[model samples]
Target chain A: SQTIHQWPATLVQPVGSPLSLECTVEGTSNPNLYWYRQAAGRGLQLLFYSVGIGQISSEVPQNLSASRPQDRQFILSSKKLLLSDSGFYLCAWSVKRGQPQHFGDGTRLSIL
Target chain B: AQSVTQLDSHISVSEGTPVLLRCNYSSSYSPSLFWYVQHPNKGLQLLLKYTSAATLVKGINGFEAEFKKSETSFHLTKPSAHMSDAAEYFCVVSPIYNDMRFGAGTRLTVKP
Candidate 1:
């Protein structure tokens, strides 16, 4: 069975600090990875998605970016965090396009 | 382009009562639709998906949804609501490739 894992389940960061969130998939290969942010009591906003290593597409322009270094390892990073960056960060993986995506336990980030 | 709309922002239902959460979608092609549930501060889990197969799709936890192409709707339903069913539900749509869109989630509250 395929599973996705994300780290630092919750984080409190100061403004202008750096941000890094990692996501990895187990029992899956060459899976498409995605980064999403959800505001409190709101819908998910797609931030970035990657098809393969070093390939990423940004859906909404933001202070964050995403990278795929390995086949199943994805990273979401920010050079300097903004207050608006505070939200619930979620990582997801899909075997194929138009298929259901599997999500990891999200990282609740609070920027002060 | 594909997009989903979850009509209800929140719904309250008594235990053992029928549950209904409405969703509508727009897609350019034969789209793939999905319903997902998210526990508080947890990852999103797939409830069901419709991909040009049967209009009625059954998912985990005794949940089901009907895909009505003419109405462009895919509403989730359950015969009896359970306390454990209290969560956020999302409607998703995908047209072809990495063009997945999510609806603003609907929060389901099952009262005892």
Candidate 2:
């Protein structure tokens, strides 16, 4: 019985502003964490993934970066936001590689 | 490396009718496949997965998919479509020790 929590479900930020989104999972230990973005009318794009604390992998290099400071805590942050950064951001967790991932409710970020 | 292709970008089906969404994948070895559904502005929900076990996998909401090795296909189907079933569907392929590859996604529209 694991659940993921994502904060700031809806965010509106001005251009060049900083951004920070948090995601944490409960009832799971040492799970793989992932960050994904979904643009309007498009599929998801993997931004980053972490197998363990302080072990982050970038799937698609972009303005966004992710950090796994704790075993079940992941944070996505950006020093300055761009217009292209506006999208539905999702955080997912999986028991391990080649396993099904459970997704959080996601955060709708709109850059003004 | 693993790649997934969702055959149709959008599909319209009448209520109570059979529903079908086609998907194809490419991988060097036996890959893990999954189907997920997402409502508008919502996170993904795992429908089913194929991990070289059962050829036919049943998922929630009365949806199921069959894995075809020769064709490298995993097509999703439902006996009867419901209005609530209208959403976007995704096909994903996860190779061993690699990041998961997602398809372009196929949007299923259920008409009354």
Which candidate ranks first by lDDT, i.e. highest?
2
DockQ of every predicted complex: 0.84, 0.80
Ten contiguous residues with the weakest lDDT in model 1 chain A: A93-102
Measured over all alpha carbons after superposition, the RMSD of each candidate to the real structure, in angstroms, is 1.0, 0.8
lDDT of 2 at B51: 89
Candidate 1: where is the Cα deviation over 4 Å?
none
- Runs of candidate 2 with Cα error greater than 4 angstroms are none
Global CA lDDT of candidate 1, please?
Answer: 0.92
Q: Which model scores highest in DockQ?
A: 1
Query: What lDDT tens digits, residue by residue, belong to model 2 across residues A14-110?
Result: 9999999999999989999999999999999999999999999998878888999999999999999999999999999999977888999999999
Please state the error at residue B52 of candidate 1 in Å. 0.9
Task: List, residue by residue over B7-108, the lDDT tens digit for candidate 1.
Answer: 999999999999999999987767889999999999899999998999999999999999998999999999999999999999999887755788999999
Task: For candidate 1, write residues A24-89 as lDDT tens digits.
Answer: 999988998999999999989889988888999998887888889899999999999999999999
Q: What proportion of the true contacts does each candidate reproduce?
A: 0.93, 0.74
lDDT of 2: 0.95
Per-residue lDDT of B81 in model 2: 100
